[model samples]
Target: MSRSIDINKRTELKRLLLTLDVKAIPLWGKMTPRQMVEHLVDQVQWTNGKKTATCDRPAEEAERARQLMIYTDRDIPRNIFLEDLPDEYLYPDMETAINQLMTELDDFDEYFKKPGRIAIHGGFGPMNYDEWLIWHGKHFGHHLMQFALM
Candidate 1:
C-alpha cells in the first residue's frame, strides 16, 4: 500500500466521482451517493477536528477489523467497508450530493498536501499523516470502483 494519498490522485478520483451518474453502490449494499461521500469525508473531518468517534469497539470486534485490514498474510477484501459509515444528511439530489462531496474531498486534498498532521481515525487509532493517507486511499478507492457506471 502506498504511504501517501497524493492530491493529484484525489483530484483524478474527484473526476471519476463527479462524473458518476450513480445514486448508490449496489454490491457493497445500498448507500445513496451523498451517503457514501459523506461517509468517507467524515474521516477527513475526524482528522481535521470537525468530528470525533469513540473507539468503543470491544476487544473481539476491534481485533477482527484490525486483522482483516492490517494482516500481512491475506489479501484485503474488496466487498466490505472496514466499518459502518455515516449518512446523516439526506441529500435532495445528485447534483447537490456530488457538489458537497467534491468540496469536502478538495478540503482533504489540500490538507494532505501539508503533511505531518496527526490523524485520529475512528477505528484505526491515531496515525501520522502518511498512514492516514493509505487508509483513505483504500477506502475512497473502494467506493470509486463500486460506484463506477456499469
Candidate 2:
C-alpha cells in the first residue's frame, strides 16, 4: 500500500510530475502525459471542494465500501475507466497541465491542514481529509506507474 499524501508525499508527487516530459508516453494507459495531468488536476479539485461527485450509495455504506477497497496491500485494479468527466479536454500542453496540477496539489495540501469533510469521491463515497489524502496518494502512485515513474 502507498503512503498517504501529507506534506512529504505531496512534495514527492510534485517531483515525480516534474520528471515527465511533454512527449512522455504511457507504458500502459491510454492517456497522454498531459491528459494524465489533467485527470490528476480534476481529482485534486474534487478533494478541495472545487468539484463534486454524485454518491451511488448512502454515506455510511459508501464509506464502508471505501474502507474495504483501501485497507489492503493490493494495487487498485488496473484499467479502471472513469465516466462523465467534466471537460472534453482540459489542458492543451504538458507544461500548462503540470502547472495547473501543481497549483491544485498545493490547494489540496492546504486543505488537509484543517479538519473537515472533503468532497465526495465518485466511487468511494464521502471522505474526510485524511481519507482523501490516502485515496489520492494511492491513485497518484498508480498513474505514476502507468507512465513508468515508479
Candidate 3:
C-alpha cells in the first residue's frame, strides 16, 4: 500500500492535522480523533527514546517482524489492537493532542540527528534512526488513513 502522506513532511502533516477536529469520526477503528492524535504522540515519544518499552516478543521474532515492517511497502493492517495503550484520550482537546504530536515529531528528528542513535521498540527490538523513521511513516500513515485524512 502506498502512503497518502509522508510523515517526514512536517508542514504538510500540520496542515492535514489542522483539518481534523473533535467531531471527526474515524472511517475505521474505535479511536476518536483526539485519541488517535494522543496515540501518535505516545508513539513518537517512544520512537525518539523519550519513553521506554521492553520488547514483548522473542528477540529473533522481533527482528524478523522489524525487518518486514521497516523494509516492505505493505501498509499496517487495519483494526490491530494494542492492549498496552490506553483506550481513553490523554489530552483534553484535539488541538492540544495534535500540538503535542508535532512537538514529539520535532524531538524525534532532533534525537535522531546524531549518528548511531538507537531506540527500543516494544515489538521491534532495537532499531536505529532510519528504521524508526520507516516505522513512524508507516504508523502515522496508517492512522491518517483511518481518519480518512490521507
TM-scores for all candidates: the values are 0.64, 0.81, 0.91
Residue-wise C-alpha lDDT for candidate 3, range 64-113, written one tens digit per residue: 99888888887788899975557667787777888888889989989988
What candidate 3 gets wrong by more than 4 Å, as runs, is 84-88
Candidate 2 segments whose C-alpha is farther than 4 A from its true place: 1-8, 58-61, 84-89, 112-114
| Per-model CA lDDT versus the true structure | 0.58, 0.73, 0.84
Instruction: Give the per-residue Cα lDDT of candidate 1 at 136.
Output: 62
Best by lDDT: 3
Model 2 local distance difference test score: 0.73
> Model 1, residue 141: displacement in angstroms?
1.0
What lDDT is obtained when candidate 1 is compared to the true structure? 0.58
Ranking by TM-score: 3, 2, 1
Decide which is better by lDDT, 1 or 2: 2
Clash totals in order: 0, 0, 0
Deviation in Å, model 2, residue 34 alpha carbon: 0.6
lDDT of 2 by residue, 24-78 (tens): 7777757877778788888789876677777887777877778876665456667
